[model samples]
Target: MKRPPYLKTSIGIGVLFIILMFLQSWLEKQPEALTASSEPETQTEATAVQPSERLVEDKRVYEGHNGTNLEHVYITIFDQSAVPENDITFYDLNESYKQYSNLDSGPKLDILFQTGTAKGPSDNGFISFGTDKPNATIELRGRSSRLEAQKSYKIRLQDNGGLWYGQSVINLNKHADDRTRVRNMLAFDYFRRIPDLISLRTNFVQLHVKDLTDPSSEGKFKSYGLYTHVEQLNEEALAARGLNPDGHLYKAENFEFYRYPDQLNHQNDPNYDKKKFEQVLKINGNENHDELLQMLDDINDLSKPFDEVFDTYFQEDNYLTWLAVNILFGNYDTMSTNYYLYSPLNSKKWYFIPWDFDKALGRDAERTDGLPQWQQGIQRYWGTVLHRRYLRDPENAAALTAKIEELSAIITEKTTKELIDSYYPVVKQLALQEPDLSYLGIEASEFDPAYRKLEQVTSRYKEQYMKSLEVPMPIFLHYERKNGRDVFTWEASHDLQNDKLSYEFQLSKTPGFESLIMQIKEQPDFTYNMAALPAGRYYWRVLVHDDKGHEQIPFDYYRDNAGIVYWGVQQIVVPGGSSS
Candidate 1:
């Protein structure tokens, strides 16, 4: 039978699944047999285990096979459920040990442990056993209505440190009805089904441990590694370059430099020579500065052709698709704090690379509040006010609006679903094969219900936003002649039935718009020309008023505010102009 394109792809995917299943069966069966056969001996010893004996038994030692000198000690979990005497299990470790769980109809199991240690080269010096390291501990918590229960689980080591650098998967537990068992089984199957798509990036492994000294502390007793985070240069990099602590051009050393706690102070007030650091940054590198500024200007220019590019490159519906995805995924830590920009030997252009993704996948607690304040205010503050005066004039707003609409279209349900479906097999394969990999968590299916809900809501908001953009007016011309005359023109239309369409124009040189050239009102299709203007870049826009004493609500205006409707602004260059 002839298969459709999508069907052919689906069938190919199914075949891959079969192969993975075969591989997983082979891999899991070996481990299952070993565990089952050893159960009797383990149970026999456990039966004879006394409180004092169990206390000693609770301490487990893990030694790296490689030359790496890493070691860890863990306290086993003590099952407290009211099960049969034979089914009961006990450990000397407290309940505060670490726990991990899977909530998507998969597995549930808690691993409790204490203390881990590592020495020699195997320790890699990159691993940390305390609470100071970020993501040192991984917790699996769930809110469930099926059993009317909300539970938090912890899994940790006896002693926190180990040096088996490279990738390793450790199965904490396997039981007939265990959620972790089920989840791992499914993940292994997925990986076996598509091995080619998976890759593992790290090898260090350590068990979670309870902070015996601080049991009640939040995020206490975690496992983590200490590795140098290679800084990335990207959009946030540009923001970093433009960041000024005092908001002044001088005093360049006032900027804060930080890596980890104890590396540097919150603000640099050291006795080091200010000129030395300034020379290192070379803030006066005019050519490099121009190139960086040009890149920013290009991004701004992209706003004008947004609709056309979105339609042709991203499909009309997918406008702002990438931006929306980033937001939905909780890439909210994009402010200047965690990212940096650098130039090697005065490069003409700067490039941006993503440095951190731990914040992605909506892992942070505060991320559930929906869109951030800064994003919501982009249109009002950036589009309406700042952009109007500095970035682009009102006439450019229409093009930008069209562009945003196109971007939104590109990220529509059909498109997003297609993207997810296409990547599902690959993501699942990676998750299964490299379950211990950091930064990249398991596939979409493993996410908590809250995470899924947040993603859906964010996507809907982006869609609605695209639909709400009003049509925009275009800036026609912005130029100043050598004669000290400044002229601004825009393509005008009088589609309204109201007569005597009055127009007004305003000019300002500064961003706050303190400097004014003139303010006048006339009919639609009006042009304003002024002479004796200073010779620097200027911003100007037009407004329309109805003669019938009725105010035309600024529907399409970049900033929806009363009074003076804005057309757009232009830069005027006068011959022999000087900054006043």
Candidate 2:
């Protein structure tokens, strides 16, 4: 067969194109070579600044990591030696359990940290540390998780050192209570995709640590197992996230929107104690707190309408989106704390940014039963003054519901299911290895069910959100000993329909209220008088009922060491010879 001239030329070009495509594919499949040196592989100014520029332009790729984006990090601890020329040895690094008691605010230890990159699925990561002695300080971090044998950590780059992926402080969360180990990361990842909400950067990290505190010990780095590296919320983080770094930022340590006259005064006030102020709201950026105090004052003043204050002092979309995300995720711990408040220098509006979501997505519910019975709805936020005022209005409540529905449509069950599926294989094998396995909250055999349960956790919370709109907000119960008698009092519940309300008060010896020592029902008054309780401990609760037959429990709850929450229960202890 004879071919024409043009046909022959076309055949030649086709063959060449296939060969080049095969060559490119082969090159792409190969692993990336290890960097020759560890001094951060010097880069031109432009190359170094491009990522940050891209961050300002495109937020989608900000701190974005895939399911398979598992990274390895090595940290080597060293003593505070004055001699800079001394050789590093196993004796330089030491471990002492006595110093680990206060992980919440303990002093940090100087450590040399290095990170590795794996370009492909089959690549084995490597670390390089050349002449960069110790550039950071590491401290045991977390509130309750500090009690766990395995601990989370806070790593801060010190001495004007280089940034770790454009961050000064890095929070590596172990999520000790969550067996799935990815609930916190999942929440942040999902929020990152939502436009209305401000999201932080997060990635999966595998940590290795070596302790040379003991002279006789070998200083080999041991696998600390898998951790989720959540970017610390600070001025640097805010700037990177496109926020006003020079604006006010405060982490709610124990703030409930109260105008604490004695504690939370301005820095210029004579009685203003920084320690006392920090106990309630930890100052993170822009120490000037006049705006925050003003907002708190407005929230505390019942004379001002909440909607007006909300419109004047808050971004409506930001507030609603934060509330809606927390509701759907079931992050009930945010009533007084576990969130950040920010206000730009030029604006009167305050914004809510979520933090510490480890307890969200039914992770707590899986460990505890009946925890969400009272904590599941808009009423769950009644403990906070701001939320109480906001939710008391029907319009704001409906607005929150609409926001929840909007987010629900975007982050559907299938969407979450795919996320869980993607994250499962990445941490499955690593979770079973070394330290993580020893501290595993659930059995190895239960990972499948745990993840499967997580897929439906958010949706279940959404259903609860809808049902919560049917009931009134839970009342705040008060107790005092008055003239030899025990008096129980609580605020009247706010019903949307303006229905007649009645109270049912029950006193019990056990927390579960299995047997009631005293039961008072169908009472119209908010106050109940009873004889002095015995010199032992007792439990009590008040249930609210409406004319249309809607019932709701109180906002109070009792939490045990196991994280089990008993809702609507309050405890009283009587001294043998004194009325209390």
State, as a TM-score between 0 and 1, how close model 1 is to the true structure.
Answer: 0.28
Q: Model 1, poorest ten-residue lDDT window? A: 53-62
Pairs of colliding residues, candidate 2: 93-212, 93-213, 94-212, 94-213
Best TM-score among the predictions, by candidate number? 2
* Residue lDDT tens for model 1, 502-539: 55666676423477767665634555566667556566
Candidate 1: list runs displaced more than 4 Å: 1-347, 350-374, 377-447, 471-580
Please give, for residues 1-580, the per-residue lDDT of candidate 2 as tens digits. 0012112247677687677667767855655321111112232222222211111112533634453488777776764462243334333212223455434445566677677543211112212333236667777677676666777788887644467777878788888878888888788878767755667778888887666553444856677789998888887776664455777889888888899898999889999888889889988888888888888888888898666777778766677888899989999888888999877666687778899888888865666474645588778788788887877766666678878888988778888888888888877887876778877877888877877888888889999988878787788788888999999998888876677788999989878999999898987789898898878878888999888788888877876567666788887777773343
Error of model 1, residue 215, in angstroms: 14
lDDT of 2: 0.73
Give the root-mean-square deviation of each candidate in angstroms.
22.2, 15.1
Q: Rate the local accuracy (lDDT) of all candidates.
A: 0.31, 0.73
